[model samples]
Target: MAVRSYFLDCASLRDYLQGIWHEVAYDGLNSVVAGALVQLAFGVVKQTESDVFADFPGQVSYETLERIITRGNTQKAEKEFSAARHALVPDDQSQESDEAFVDLKEYMLSDAYRNLVDFIVDYQKNRNGFPTMKMLMHTTPWDPGFDLQQATKEERLEWRRVYTINWLYVTW
Candidate 1:
């Protein structure tokens, strides 16, 4: 909230930029996170809820989470999130319950990314690795130029229609 509001105007983007020096910045997400999450979040900039939800279910399908994480809001969002996100992961046993750190490490590199690692991690953490397959293919970002050849325009349109329904009824 603070970041968006603060930088709502280009005039403020300059102010924040001036405040920072000698810092390596990406997306201006104010914290230094685990490199893996940073990779997922920044690596695949998303345009739809299904794309993000299919990958990261535990995360609220709301930009509020990003806004809170990056420029302000801080722990408040985290606390509210944990309370509401359990449904995303309905599994009785976490596949890596016994090996937490190892799993996080392995998950970051798994083939599951399919081009949207951040989204997948969100699903794994929140949805319990249970988002449907169609959801995955539809929401995951494909390189605009590269994916266009691999996927027909009609197929993309169909996926967009499905996503529109899913977001409208299920997520929204």
Candidate 2:
């Protein structure tokens, strides 16, 4: 029998993170920031599908949804999660010392981004028994193809033109 790997769909992943988010303190990070970080990680993994998926069949299957469910010692998990979120906060000291502007784009490339990726990767890896396929985040010039004029006001507010796609693969 071919060993199958389990993976979380976007919704499942979002739900799992929501549970974590609720357990942890905001620590200067809100749900939107957490969600964006997750999407960015996904995008990084998607970019590597060509290279990573070559060993397996091109066809993909979803793992059982239950695998993504968050459970146990939520209080402890919350504390750890809060710490990770806190790590992502832009250093006010840097801004004061150098008068440097730390923007969202910079945060995507910061140590906090790395920690968030590590935290998510570790959780998913342990929870689903999968290994990290890829984790990355990057920003580029806004795509003109996403015509803001054509988007509804609500859509424009919710739209992330530069979001990343995340993927996790496991071999059993």
Candidate 3:
């Protein structure tokens, strides 16, 4: 199935991610994968041939990006993500940490994340609905670098970089 279909049918964000990876990795003969790979290859070659390429620092090659998206180094990504999680919410504390990424399962099952997902699903079904203050507050824990509890209600409402989800699956 296509990525969009995966999104539509997915029971959770983790499921969606797995479905997307499966589409990219498991079926090289699939037209979607074949066409997308060809297009990306062409774009990479064209960009490489351009004069301004030298201006772009840390430029990633097509092969690198392809490996990242299609077949990530799962063991390494898991280890890195685990270490980050441990650093953020250390063994002694229950307080939320300022980490930007977490294990997919941890993120999906979090109260804040689940609330956001519910809001999105509701919005999709209703087509018109603004999340209440409670819904917004539910996401405060996941806001990186922002301690909502430290701020007053009015200030907390202005929280930036609020993410429904942020995860890293590394290839290298």
TM-score preference between candidates 2 and 3, better one: 2
The whole-model lDDT of each prediction reads: 0.39, 0.39, 0.43
Instruction: List ranges where model 1 is wrong by over 4 Å.
Output: 1-126, 144-172
Mind giving the per-residue lDDT tens digits that candidate 2 earns over 1-172? 0111212233345456666576555455576767776787577546544333554565442121111111233233233221112223365432222233323222222233444455455557657654334432322333547778998854443334223212222222
Q: What is the C-alpha RMSD of each candidate to the true structure, in Å?
A: 21.4, 18.9, 19.5
User: Pick by lDDT: which candidate is best?
Assistant: 3
- The number of clashing residue pairs in model 2 is 5
TM-score, predicted candidate 3 vs. hidden true structure: 0.21
Q: What is the lDDT of candidate 3?
A: 0.43
Q: Which candidate is the best by TM-score?
A: 2
Residue-wise C-alpha lDDT for candidate 1, range 10-123, written one tens digit per residue: 223333444442233644644444344445443333333344455555765334434434335534433432211222246664343231122211112122222244444445
| Clash tally for model 3 | 0
Error of 1 at 117 (Å): 15
Over 4 Å off, model 3: 1-116, 124-126, 140-143, 146-162, 165-172
Q: 37 in model 2: Cα distance from truth in Å?
A: 0.5
- Name the candidate, 1 or 3, with the larger TM-score value: 3
